[model samples]
Target: MFVLPDDDDRQFAVTLARGLEMLRCFLPGERMLANRDFVERTGLSKATVSRLAYTLTELGYLRHDVEARKYRLGGGVLSMGYPLLAGMRIRQIARPFMRELALQIRGAVSLGMRDGMNMVYIESCSADKRSDTRPDVGAVHPVLRLAMGRAWLAGVGPEEREVALNQLRVGVPDQWQRYRPQLDQAMRDFAELGACFSHGDMQKNIYGIAVPLSAPVDSETLVFNCAVMDHTPQARALLDDVAPRLIAMIANVESAAGLRQTVTTTPPRYPRR
Candidate 1:
């Protein structure tokens, strides 16, 4: 059940609401949007949007695209996120392995987790084709239409994955009910493969695979995944070589963390490579 909010909780909640609103203002697809698009997309007053945009751009969360007269993610944002992902060793342990996986597999390799209903990319190593539209760390992608999200969904138990699916309703913009059949198919497929994959789902011409992390974790512990693109039967082989390395990297991360069951009520965090 959702907790009833006290004053402190209420105030904190408000902060989160605004922060989220601000985040939605930045989309990787657009990366940079002009003021008009920003106001239209956000449905905020022009003045409010302008002020927030300016403040964020100045604060280094967003950058102004002078030529396009739009805004995009700034280096400052990466500066802040790098340490967090690095601290977790998820990227550290996974990077060398991912690059090796990408080299061996010759496709994109990514490590990701569910965060507040979206999949937050923690690490990525990719080939030229995958890099053409590569997802960056700190990029929050819809759990739907992505193999990385399915890996998380598939790795967990049925009851637990369902809870995550339910939570996805609130976290994702659209309702999950609409895609129940597809999700069910994915769940069944994951049960068989021990991993999940998708083609042209998150983006056209993109494909991937993923697995789980978090040993000694609870039923509710989030699923983690590694994904590789499928460009050819040759590239499809990347998943085979990459999967074992990803499994090993996850094991290394778990061993580093000592397999303790410390539930972080807050979301899991990862630092950069």
Candidate 2:
């Protein structure tokens, strides 16, 4: 579930919010869920979950499996996203660049935008066709720990970043404590190195470098990330080899998108081998 608006807000639609939150209970791997599962995941009463599930099923947002007595997301949910993705022109412009970088690094490149307190990948490219863990277009990741998220925070205005930080602090206190220092370092890196680096902070064997676009697209700040997954993580190689290329790739993307002439950043020179 995501952060709810203040209870006192007069125009907030409680039932609608609850219904949407129910949909969010479906994770990537878990496809089907019973009313009891919704109750446990959403903290809504069984009766409320039942009503919402039935309503959503009627609306075509969910499909009820009579035999399995479970619910799964329906075509309506996917249809809802098509317009949003289609409207994001930046994704089209960035895909070629992202694919090139992914192939060069033999890793994954993704473009994402903030969704509530998390970041959702709008586009992803991976060189490894057979890798099970390749980032997918709809995958969501926390904003506090990942390089893509940190770069976003680094690029945004201070007031916006502060508001997001306050939300994270209240919503996930443990994560705030564990990743705050790393986020601070990432901010410095963004200032000095033109990108933010995640040295296996997101996942045990994954390293990433990310940079935010110089300008927002359709008033939405977007971030691009390049991730390398390996059993033997190499932080220096990410900084010295991957970071420069990722920065340049973002610069080229920004230029192509006409967001700016080009990104102006003091990217570190690639280390001579």
Please, what is the whole-model Cα lDDT of each candidate in the order they appear? 0.62, 0.84
* Candidate 1 weakest ten by summed lDDT: 264-273
Error of 1 at 201 (Å): 1.5
> For residues 197-247, what per-residue lDDT tens digits would candidate 1 score against the true structure?
666666776656666664424323434454444555565655445545555
Candidate of highest TM-score: 2
Q: How far is candidate 1 from the true structure (C-alpha RMSD, Å)?
A: 8.1
Off by over 4 Å in 1: 1-9, 13-16, 29-31, 34-36, 45-76, 127-134, 156-163, 170-179, 216-249, 252-257, 260-273
Question: For model 1, which pairs clash?
Answer: 32-71, 84-270, 84-271, 85-270, 85-271, 85-272, 86-271, 86-272
- lDDT of model 1, residue 112: 70
Q: Each model's TM-score? A: 0.67, 0.89
Candidate 2 per-residue lDDT, tens place, 1-273, comes to 434686679888889999999998888799899998898888888898999999999999999999999999999999999899999988999999888888877788899999866899999988787753367788888898789999999999999988988888997799899999999999888888888878678787787788888887899899988888765245345446788888788888888888768563444475442
